[model samples]
Target: MKIHLRSSLLCIGLLVLTACQSTSSPSQNNSAKPHEIAALFNQSTPEYKPETEANRTDKNIDSDITSDSKPIVYDDLWQEVIANLAFDIVPTPRLQKRIDWYLKQPDYLLKVNKRAKPYLFHITQKIKQKGLPMDMVLLPFVESDFRPKVHSSQSAVGIWQLMDSTAYHFGVTTDEWYDGRQDVLASTDAALDYLVYLYQRFNGDWLHALAAYNTGEGRVKKAIRQSKKQGKQGYFWQLKLPSETADYVPKLLALSYLLQAKHPKFKVPKLPNYALTSEVDFAQRFDFSVLASLTGVSKNQLHRLNPGYLQHQSAPEGPHKILLPLTEKQLWQSEFFQRYFSQTYTVVKNDTFYGLARRFNTSVNTLMALNNKQTTLLKVGEVLKIKKAQPLDNLMLEYQVSPYLAQEEKKPVLTMEHEYIIQNGDSLWEISKQFNVPVKDLLTWNNLKSSSLLKPGKKLVLHLPRPAKTPKKPEPKKFLSELEQLVKPNTSP
Candidate 1:
């Protein structure tokens, strides 16, 4: 009887998995033994159905199941966030004051959640993968109010608030065309790398590490040294730092508490583990306008996700990345998509993918892939591969899929010429050195006489040389040794 009961339970479990109505054989008899019935349960298979075309083509697959279908008020990511918070910040009056500041703003929590909806899931998901605390996602909120294009008075830029020098030290590339410090995921990665470095530098004390992140590491270290010299312990709380630096850790802790607080005013969105499978990497330069048309995502939306781009187009030098819905990947790969709308379109107006589909006689799924694969539109009068067409989707921005995207204003450059004004203590040679051009070239570029004195604030034209090719590589050690041997051969004789 015990065996029969156990078998019955196992059979029920199997039935639940495959959605089968019964685990029993139709010809079962009362005389059948419990062991025999149990065997039938083990042998039972899930009901099979023909594969649907939707399954064959990912375009039809519903991303909205998680992105939009569920109620927006509840997010499982919050539970995971609260569960993984292991920070050692003790409650203090300063922290409470910061908490009061955050709480006082009626819209602050909502603002954070609203700006973070698209990225928080991905950030939190990555944090979990690293076994780090989930509250790290709140850093961007504290840094730039989640604004990617913001430039601080301190010269810090991007969501991570990384200064140009600091960004380069962390291996983030900054150039005229692109600044990796402003790139959303790229900056996040660099920031985390810096965080890990700081954590190790301070001997695993996160409080001090976080302080160092806001202020410089040297400042924090100096504070520690100064504190120890004054007979105070070299701890984060005890050390005297700048007023803003002192408030920094407490601010983070206060925000951390609010996220974990489960206050009724805050509604965590439904961000699942699979929310960020959309990010994809492309190893070549691509056009964002065509991508906007293809994916039906707005140009503004694309810029928000990839803030590193200085121009509308991607850098001429790339391996670029864009986030597309997972289901759209299949449709993008479909022959139908290739034949009809395989080509790209540039953004003329803020438009929806569905609107473009309606205007161009294409399917929404066909356009979804295009919208998500944006690259760049760098220079004006830039040769566009996709033909120009006035879009019929003027109201498409109303249905924009992305909630946050920075506006990119277009300014026409009338000429290729660059001008520089003379500054104090500047000479022709110094100006030449600043531009890495020969002084002769500078004179020629500006049509200046050799005897002319540079007037401060006078504008001078600079037809700079094209970027230099890499300098010649040093000869191999063995090659140099052989050269020395050749020269010294008479000594051996």
Candidate 2:
């Protein structure tokens, strides 16, 4: 990339020189009058300067600023990171290549770095607490490019790129209401724990641990066992791992090297390693809509700050916390809680969903989604969920039983089976979560193989489990002896 840039600059320089020579050459001045000639000669033709180092590049070194040992002077988050960076590993050619790639996209790295500001301190602090390799501080960049909510085809989530299984194994709960894997706090805690586990599992060899983090510890162990069969052992580079797994460590090391460069292309933001934060602790499960109304926090901003929440609302259990802006911490606590309440109302004649929506200042669609109701029908005297987490109501009972499990426990709840058409980008796992059904049951009902990919617009039959019935009478405990009694007095025996 640097070579390409330098070549272009050199080409432009040649073009400018050619144009200047054509316009100001002695031969070209032959057409000028005596006065013009005298003026040109008297003025002493301006000298054309050769390309200097400031504008020139080494092409091979790929940078104007050289040496990683010197202190870099850019005032930003990245520069501070470089100043504090401590790593046991050194740069290699592969690392240089990744550095070249990153340098080529000055805007992209800058953007991603800006996105990582909130997370860096927390992640680095945790890594430090665990005595992890400094290179791990930049692992999130290689995983998700620092995009917290970005998902992959492999179903990995958040900056850590933790798969659902890994996330769950690490106690990062994921369900219909929330996915802790996408939460900055939860995911970071889980990721560091998993990293620590890997580090210990591989006997303190960070390279193997890192590779295992990417490709799974089992695969790395298997590769090690294979290498041992050939009388080679405990060497990560010697193992024949998957292509991505092999390149994963190189990518991180390359980033570490680039970050330590004495000269950087851009300034990283100078953000504090620890930023002030305020926590809103709910005594019970709370409605996000009501919470938003009370606190004046927009749901969109909440979503950005709290991506772990799978639904708009937080989990329906106590000890659920929502982070609020530290600047308005006091206002949120004093003002919002005073005004909040969870209340339900009975449907009355002439009361419509639209009217209730207008009363609550919410949309009809939001009401339908919140209540899980269809159509505009409202029966007189029927109870409707107007609000949740009413300060005066029994907030404890609201979350004690999950609606998902409660509905399932009430047998014959589903009136009729239906066929659903698969949509674009739909996966069976996600679909099952949406419908609160098991993926295995979804496959069994459709008579499809587990490995089948869903086709868009393809109809899939859904059959709900039937309720269990009690036996009318006790059945006989007939065995070999009982069967002989039913026969001719056990004569044959």
Candidate 3:
């Protein structure tokens, strides 16, 4: 009877187990099974979706966490920047002072954030790809407040504030038509290359690299050597540096710290993670006015987006790439774009590729390729297509001048041309001081080098600003002292 009871009980247990398996949800069943649990572990992780406005909140930004408890990949570009911050700056008076200064001017930060939206994604992406510290992304903010076309009194140009020599050393070309220093794409690459080189040169010390970036590497090395001689390890903070260099690193550190803190009063302006601008390269030189018309983007906007182009048109040679709003990328690929911009000329007697190329402001190779010709030979009456170069005046009236171009326009044109012959013992410095111009400008104006020996009687061309007449101050009314008053009468008139 006991054996019979045991068998019945065992059968009941098996029946119960089967019933549970049948009634349980799939998820429950999976959780119960060992193999299913292993499969769950092997499953691919969920892909990150860009945060939507509905899902993004102040709490999400501050905590970087979702309601369901998943760590947010990124709520926006700012969040991404914050996540990648690798610096741990100890609080110092200078750092606190900078932080305090930034905190007081919340509006300034907002303005910079707004200006940075169009560029932050590209800059951040480059920094990420290079495995650089996120601090480098804010370097432009410190350099030029993110102004791509800004120039400093020290001759540093562009958002990177790259000096002329540094820009040239990094293969950034400058000419009357184009200044690569103002080209965000070219200058960013050059700046990062320089920073990486400095980082490596300083034995992987980022602070030292940054300081070297502010003041030259030679100065930083000298400071380090001086510190070492004084029986101290050469850290950036430990070494004595110029007031500017000392404040520079602290400012960067302060910015990084404040940004990471997620303060309520100081919020980073909302900018999407996606690129705001897309660079489109043309096969030949293109006109900005034509681009503006084609994309329905204003001329001012086009100029702001492509400040590298000094004039209304792109460089005659190449780098015919222009940054347009990413939304306009589709316009470039549309059939109408090609049909509208394309121009054709009928070949006449004695028509040659070279002549047509010169006439069209393009290259012979480009002309031949456009016409699908294997050789430079041209046949009469054959229609060959070319890119249209629009007239500047026709489009200049369509839109207001961009702030970048307006600043250029407002500059006092140095119209007065002067020819100065070098005198004996006249140094470039002395000549520059006498002319009230920079020595660098003197070198550039004369196509002379800093090391070039100035010879007597050598002529130098200078474009000086029109001299302003100084109003002579009326002679101060003569006042007689008490003793003089007693000695002589003073005129009241």
**lDDT winner between candidates 2 and 3:** 3
For residues 1-493, could you state the per-residue lDDT of candidate 3 as single tens digits? 0000001111111222222211111121111222221122122122222221110001111123233443235758877777657564445565689888788877666788776777788777666544455668899998777877665546677889888667655556677667787788778867876675565556555677789898998899999999889986676667899998888877777788788787776767777777878766665666675677766778789877877776676666866777776644465455445445566789999988888889878898888776778988778989898775443233232225566554544322312335688899999999899989999988997789999998898768675763343222222223112112222323678
Question: What is the lDDT for 127 in model 2?
Answer: 45
TM per prediction = 0.53, 0.52, 0.55
lDDT per residue (tens digit) for residues 299-321 in model 2: 56665676667555566653266
- The TM-score of predicted model 1 comes to 0.53
The best candidate by TM-score is 3
Candidate 2: residue 424 lDDT (0-100): 97
* Candidate 1, 1-493: lDDT as tens digits: 0000001111122222222111111111212222332223233222221221000001111111332232223346666665545443334565679877776675775656665666776665444333234456778988877866666657577778987666654446766656776676677756765664565456455667788899988899999899889986576767788898888777777777766665565454445544643564444565566567756667667766666765555666653676653334554554434444435555454455555566767766545444443533233333222322233232123214533432433431211224688988889988888877788877886679888999998877665332323212232344223223222223554
- Order the numbered candidates by lDDT, best leading: 3, 2, 1
Better of 2 and 3 by TM-score: 3
Which consecutive 10 residues in model 1 have the weakest lDDT in total?
A: 1-10
lDDT of 1: 0.55
Candidate 2: segments with Cα more than 4 A from true spot: 1-80, 327-493
